[model samples]
Target: MAFRDLAMAMVYFSQTLIGTVGNVLLLYHCSCLHFTKSKLRPTDLILKHLLVANSLVILFRGVPETMAAFGLKDFLSDLGCKLVLYVHRVGRGVSIGSTCLLSVFQVITISPRNSRWTDLKLTAPEYVSIISILCWILHMLLNTIVLMYVTDRRCHKNITYRKEFEYCSTIRQQKSRTILHAALLFLPDALCVGLMLWTSSSMISILYRHKLRMQHVRKTNFTQRSSPETKATKTIILLVSTFVCFYSLSSIFQALFTLYNNPDRFLVNVAAVVTGGYPTVSPFLLIKHFPCISNLTDCVRNKKTYNVKRIMQLS
Candidate 1:
């Protein structure tokens, strides 16, 4: 393999392994086995869904990109491409929806009691299942069109108009169908990003005001800034920021590919880099926020270090 391909393979492998491991651990802790509480928070419910989505994204995206880096071509059959790409898109759409829901719920949770959204805070947990079902239904419906163009046909014969999926042949769609396809893919993305921005901004505002109130009340005393609501809002903001950055970068590369009719390897690599950002960063951000996770991480790290030291002494 060329140096570039080797580097890309390293990036893909490391991100895939780290992201999958962290997200799996997060899922386990947030599942029925909660060491810290008897009941899960509404946001925790949303996060469970996000973890599943991120795991799927990591698997489909990381595996293909790594195989391509090592010069493995056409490893997927027609049915495999359809299933893998469909699941990837669905997972991505669910991730976007879950992030939006998480942000909105956090905003409601922190809103003043007399605010218009107060009712949602009290009842958000009840609607979690409904929201998850709607998200899956919407994405599954939107992604059904994937079956039309994804195939195992040879694509190198006409490289000028072909989009570069690892194991799929590109087929031309009608103009009207193309517009509808774009709408189906990008409409929900735009809505999710807009909603997240609005809600996350509101959360930051509420957090700032709360900080000011705390400062006023405890001007003469030392106070902790680590209230549960405060910490949760901060985590939401970090997650949203990471998502926006990666999503924007990927979309820009995609637009460039479309404008130029086909992208070279470098642009494709840049796009691939964006795919790993959120799945890798989110788990660590969440780990620091949850006390249970923090304790778990410390114990694991200590044990691993002890094993390494013992191995060195033996060697």
Candidate 2:
């Protein structure tokens, strides 16, 4: 394999390992702890489901790309290509849907009773799972069209377009398909963005209210960290920030590609890097934010310190 391929393989392999291990640890931590014990106060069931979806994204998308980067494309026959791309798309869509629901739930939970979305907290969980399932189903249907376009055409005897290639379907057919994909993606994307903004605004209002109450209690400029609501707000804020960063980078790169006369492979790779980068970083960020993970790290550090101290005493 070429050096470029080796480098790409390394990147994918590293991302897969990091995402898988981080999310697995997070899932384990969430499972072991009582939901009430955590400041964030996520339902145990919801956390488990979210982690399962994240795990699917890493395993389905990350692992396949890693294998392809390593030049292991022989197994990627027509059927394999369809299966891989389909599962990856499904997983990606599910991630977006689940995260969006999580944001909306946070917003609704934090919103006052008089707020328009206050009732959503009651209905959100039930519908959120349905929405997630529907996301996977919708994307699966949309990308099945991809199977028609994706073919294993040989190039220079040992080269091809990375196991799958999008052929130019009839112009009408292609436009229709692209439009369908775009439309489905736009709804969720818009909802997620709007909910993120609303949730963030609501969180600010809640903080302000708390600030006012604290002032009456003679606390000056103090922030609220003791409440379960505040912690959940922080988690949603971080999740939204991660989504915005990745999605924004992807949009910028895509726009650049369309605006420029000829988008280079380097920029294309950059686009791919951004698109595939979120899963790699998200779990790590969650771990950093979660106190349980912080405790685990602290425990490890303390153990190391104790071992070193014992060695020093012996010496």
* RMSD to the hidden true structure, all candidates: 6.7, 8.1
Write down the worst ten-residue block by lDDT for model 1. 31-40
* C-alpha positional error of residue 72 in candidate 1 after TM-score superposition, expressed in Å: 0.7
TM-score for candidate 1, residues paired by index: 0.87
Query: Compared with the true structure, what per-residue lDDT tens digits does model 2 show for residues 1-315?
Result: 889878877877887788888888887677445422433344444555666767777787677666766766655555665566566666666666667667667777777788787667677666655665676676667556556544343323333223222211111134576567557656766676777777677777876886677766654335434566777677777777888889788878866753553466467556656766776676776675566676776545555666687789999
Residue 87 CA displacement from its true place in model 1, Å: 0.7
Candidate 1, pairs of clashing residues: none
Regions more than 4 Å wrong, model 2: 33-43, 73-75, 117-131, 155-173, 219-225, 254-264, 288-315
Error of 2 at 159 (Å): 16
lDDT against the true structure, per candidate, is: 0.80, 0.64
For residues 90-168, what per-residue lDDT tens digits would candidate 1 score against the true structure?
9989999999998888888889998898777778879988998899899999999887777664534543445655556
Candidate 2: minimum summed lDDT over ten consecutive residues — where? 163-172
Best by TM-score: 1
Q: Using lDDT as the measure, which candidate wins?
A: 1
